[model samples]
Target: MSLCIENLRAWYGAAQVLHGVNLVIGEGEAVALAGRNGSGRSTLAKAIMGLVRCEGDMRYRDVRLVGLRPYRIARLGIGYVPETRDVFPALTVRENLLLGERKGTRFTTHEAYRLFPALEARAAVKAGLLSGGEQQMLALARTLAGDPSFVVIDEPGEGLAPHVLAQVAACLKTLRERGVAMLLIEERLTIARMLDARVAVMGHGAIRFDGPIEAFARDAQVMREWLFVG
Candidate 1:
């Protein structure tokens, strides 16, 4: 499925963050959204998932998504894993993943375990006690369990150790190979490079730059101006 956003605007109460943002992630494509804090990257992600008040077009596979409830949007095969890595404190890892399951068959629990062995190993443990990286894995695995055609993942590698990060990357690679579209919001340039993804730089609630990573790299001005790199 394809995800297309055009002239998107979002607000938190009275504060507007995204200012006419436009982006598109075609089926089987992966795109990275990078920016400094308060640049509206997270807000845009939330808007796409119907988690925030939004105006403008948010479409997936030709169907309009604006004004839909968050769950309704998920029902359309779009999954969101927020940056917060919120897991059920009282639920076991298995239970948490089961909660992500849908009525139709998708990524089965067995497949999820194969993709994320650490989660399988700790299936009986309470999700709240897992390490931060583990929690992030659980969150990603749970979202993928729904077999979403497209996913909006926020900061999946925020604080992972090197090994855990590799595991996470591998899991995501499987999804990419399966042609699952992804919108990844991340601060780490390395993640973008690893995915070999097109890059979009957001600044002051708008997309300041959108192009191949190579172009963004070649143009030092974009990094300096939008991202504060010297």
Candidate 2:
């Protein structure tokens, strides 16, 4: 497995957000964590990336991830793009992308540009000036700049237009082809459906269901119960 979590638990000032979460993402696999808002989906992402305090057996290819600083985890080949799309407003697009290079993984600028042509055109522009969709591309580009073997992408389609979302979905597919595994949290089903790897349904700080995407689609009861929608 590229990533694994066993009995993961977390809290924010006594407001627990995760409980014994168990999951595994095989190498090069694209898995989605589908759930309603405030269901701990993002929290789980933070926990895996070591952005939040947690107690668990978190492992990335045999390295223990729990208790490590977020940057330390990133150095271990874990790239994280939070829901907020943490781009540097003062930095130009090129500089923003350079932040990801700290991981020391080799990747050509053209390689990232191929995944996001818009970024290529805006390379010299400040990241703060880009539209929401473009900023998302920048955020993802920054993560990919590191040439990470695995990524945790939170809500890539959250505020994007239909066309832009399609582009983002395609970019994710391209990343998967490059053998980069991912744990994707998405509100829209289209991106998850297109990826069509594995699915884990989160609810009330725990995994309500974990299996194939087909299983979630076929069992509407599970969808309605755990996901709160189809």
Q: List ranges where model 2 is wrong by over 4 Å.
A: 102-106
Top lDDT hit: 1
Residues 1-230, model 2: lDDT tens digits: 89989999999877889988989899999999988998999999999887788997989999999999888898888898999998998899888878676545556567668777888899999999999999998898888888889999999898899888888899889888889999999876678898886888888888888898888789888777876654
Assess candidate 2 and give its lDDT: 0.87
Writing each residue's lDDT as its tens digit, candidate 1 over 117-152 gives: 898999999999999988999999889888899999
- Model 1 weakest 10-residue run by lDDT: 101-110
Candidate 2 matches the true fold with a TM-score of: 0.95
